[model samples]
Target: MVTLASMEPLLPDSSRELEDLAIELTSVASRFAARLHPIMRASVGDLVRSMNCYYSNLIEGHNTLPIDIDRAMAGDFAREPEKRNLQLEARAHIEVQQLIDRGEMPYPVLSLDGICWLHGEFCRRLPDDLLLVRNPDTGEEIIMVPGQLRTRHVKVGEHIAPEPEMIEPLLARFAEAYSFKMLSKLQKIVGVGASHHRLAWIHPFFDGNGRVSRLFSHALLRDLGIGSGLWSVSRGLARNVSDYKRLLSQADQPRRGDLDGRGNLTEAGLAEFTAFFLSCCLDQVTFMEELLKPEELLNRVEVWCNEEVQMQRLPKGSWPLLREAILTGEFARSQAQALTGYQERQARTVLSSLLDCGVLTSPSSKGKVRLGFPVDIIERWLPRLYPAVR
Candidate 1:
């Protein structure tokens, strides 16, 4: 088994104080990660924005850019040829749908022992040609063997790093940790972070390790307590990839021991890496949470989602029409009637149903409903849900 370096860093930075900041930062992050759920559905716009951030980061990290998700998901962008990265993203969305449909966790059941990892654990797994990551040096992408995806020296971003192993044992470790009988929020947050760092060291598969790691990271957070699973940890890691790698490398790099011929890790370095990772999570959560406050300009549609669900159910006819209006973010209730072609009362009735579902924006104090906060979120949440609505 590969082991992390001892508690002290191999090469100390000039400033000693920079590395010891974990206690203060970790405390804040741990708290935010625990509460990410309250803010997940804060807005449909937020949902799209958060996910857009993830997709963009993923593309950017690979030295490429993606057309907006809407275009790709809808097949609206007719020109750009299908790319490996986009296929990977499409598969990830399928995984999310699988979770929604299963209405439960599957990591518990997933294993990666064979050349093939989880088959459609998420709807469909990309073929090797599409899923394999490129080698930065040779500009080659590899996908021939299962183990090679992790251990094979391939390429990502600018340089070649070890492929991470999301092999059987790793998945088992995740499933076990997730089922952690004690399951406190703090334990989940910190435990997931530790798992994140630990997986990096394992360097599991030949291709898509980083991507898989983040997908699992988000999955863990959702299983723990996050509501929407919209926020992507990869966004944070990609934001400062250099610092992220630097800290992790430092943590794994061992110090030359005095005459022992064995290397030891600087505990402080590991702590620093964990701290930075935690801080990234907290920062994202804090930024997202702010969107939910009454004062900030939250996505209106999201505001509707967060309200009480206990309102009496809307009558059947009313719900279909109303849900479309709110779900589509169409302000003119009348237009809802046009889209669904429901009769006047029928349309209004369904709209009323939406209100009762706690899925409507509360009219302002003046008793008039305006499009609730980030109206944009509907664009994402609605579209994302359509396929799974069945």
Candidate 2:
């Protein structure tokens, strides 16, 4: 039987070299997370969640746009059935992620139950057309059983997963080594990078393993507070898909002789992959940190508001209210006229235009108005965010 020994050196050696890299990852994530206000962090997190789903699906070769995803959230799926299913899939990914963000998964993220739950929740809502996979050899149709490990063998590219019977034992060992209490905070962060490849290698389900494994990593990072709802590793991975896949494939190789540690797999390969993963995450956080600089964001918004007013797309003097909302997160309903410096009637017009454009959102018309990040304006407001809806 295949055992955890084969996957030993789950992390790299604790040499000064690996330690320095790990510290760099931890430091970068901490600094990026520290720069945002609590409310802004939540807002950015919400935006990142949408981007996360988009990139995660993109990895699966589904190219749904971020604007379409926003429309799907509003229950406006595409008219075409195929396009509509993709929208549904995107919505499902976002919904399951929201559950993870809320800490609703049943067991520790690396556990058997947690993995199964993530798979089940995601697959349960998938369109029927997507629930079936065709066997390349026999032309046999296989229906994926939600939340269940495969009852038959399968191959992914050049890597054949462990036999069906070994899935539970391997996953149990996975949970044992990776559960939160078993490692220090820093080790957990490293695990977030390392476990991603290992779980993909495990490939417990017949389908959706890639998405589930990514979601699992997302949940793990969020649980550790390293992710802090501010950034996503998925965006980083999707942007570097070629290297990401190459590293994953290289990590799957058999042990490269005696120098590769005492494991049945290569320690150097795992270390390299982990380094790449952490680096991708750091890059994403850095990009967001720069993209979200307060002055730059406010200038962009001011420019956009000015352009809109010139085009009559928005009422004049709306920039002040938008600037106030961006700075304070929200402004009182009664203060709207003062902020916009418009009369009572014009103030209502400006506020209504902002609300209509999704530049602002309120739970009710009478509730406090808060800054919104509508995807339509994201290119102008948060440029280079998720490929500009192409």
Candidate 3:
């Protein structure tokens, strides 16, 4: 039976390699923010939230296409029962994530209460079909109880979970080790990577453990201020699911030898997994940074706007206001006519056209217009961010 004490050296030592990774992560995060204005950042954050949900669901083997997710968000559900349940699951994931990003749930992310709440909240909103899990060998069915720890033994593949009574105590120790006060900023970032595997290793829940662990890590990154909601670690993990699962399983191995670490779990394996996890994070941040570079992003928008204008989907001179909004993040509602360089009536035509097409969005009719990255337009505005959907 694995216990908290058995997971020795919960984090790797501060070595040159770890330091380099920490520095690069910080640098990339700073650079990513510098690439976009605040309003654009918010817009990108919303896009990323949608993408995050897509990749997260993808990792769960539910290929609810990104277009389908958008449709579901707009109140459209699939006719097929399984696909519809998957859509609801994706929506639930995004909703929970929005709450986390807003800091609405205040529990310490690594704490037992936090994990339980995360699981309960996510599972509570899931569809009825998703609430049932079957044992592969015995065909035994289990009904999941939201917000409640398991009272029976469970095995996830070759790994057996700790005794049901041991769950709370192990989680308490987890909180103590990964708590904010206990780690430096860099260590905390590293902690996020480490705890991701450790939590999954714990397999605290019967059904939603993987999703809960991903969300838990996401909340940790969000709290660390590096997450920013502008990009996600899930995308990288899902893209590299084979290596991710392999690394996670390897990290579950027993200590290799006397030099590994002073715990029952292998420090070398944990360190290797952390390195891969952080690399995934760094890769995601770098991808978004390259994708959002002002010059490249503007060019894409310009090309799209030009095509739309030629096709009469938008009024003439609409590109100027759209470009201004994209470059400056947002533009005043009053300056619409001036920015479009057109008569009042003509400018309103452009603005209204853009708004109707979701090229622009505002809080209300009288509010400032902000750039919008609608899913249908993602192919042109932001390519390869998520799988292109029809």
Provide the RMSD of all predictions against the true structure, rounded to 1 decimal. 10.3, 1.6, 1.4
Backbone clashes in model 3, listed as residue pairs: none
User: What TM-score would every model get versus the actual structure?
Assistant: 0.56, 0.96, 0.96
Model 1: lDDT equals: 0.46
Model 1: per-residue Cα lDDT over 17-123, one tens digit each: 43333333344445544543332333343344435334434534533232344343434434444554454555355445345324455334223431123323321
TM-score, candidate number 3: 0.96
**Stretches > 4 Å off in candidate 3:** 180-182
Compute the lDDT for candidate 3: 0.85
Task: List the pairs of residues colliding in candidate 2.
Answer: none
**Relative to the unseen true structure, what is the C-alpha lDDT of residue 43 in candidate 1, on a scale of 0 to 100?**
33
User: Per-residue lDDT tens digits of candidate 3, residues 193-262?
Assistant: 8899989887888888888988898898888878558889899999999999999999888889989888
Error of 1 at 21 (Å): 11
Best by TM-score: 3
lDDT of each: 0.46, 0.84, 0.85
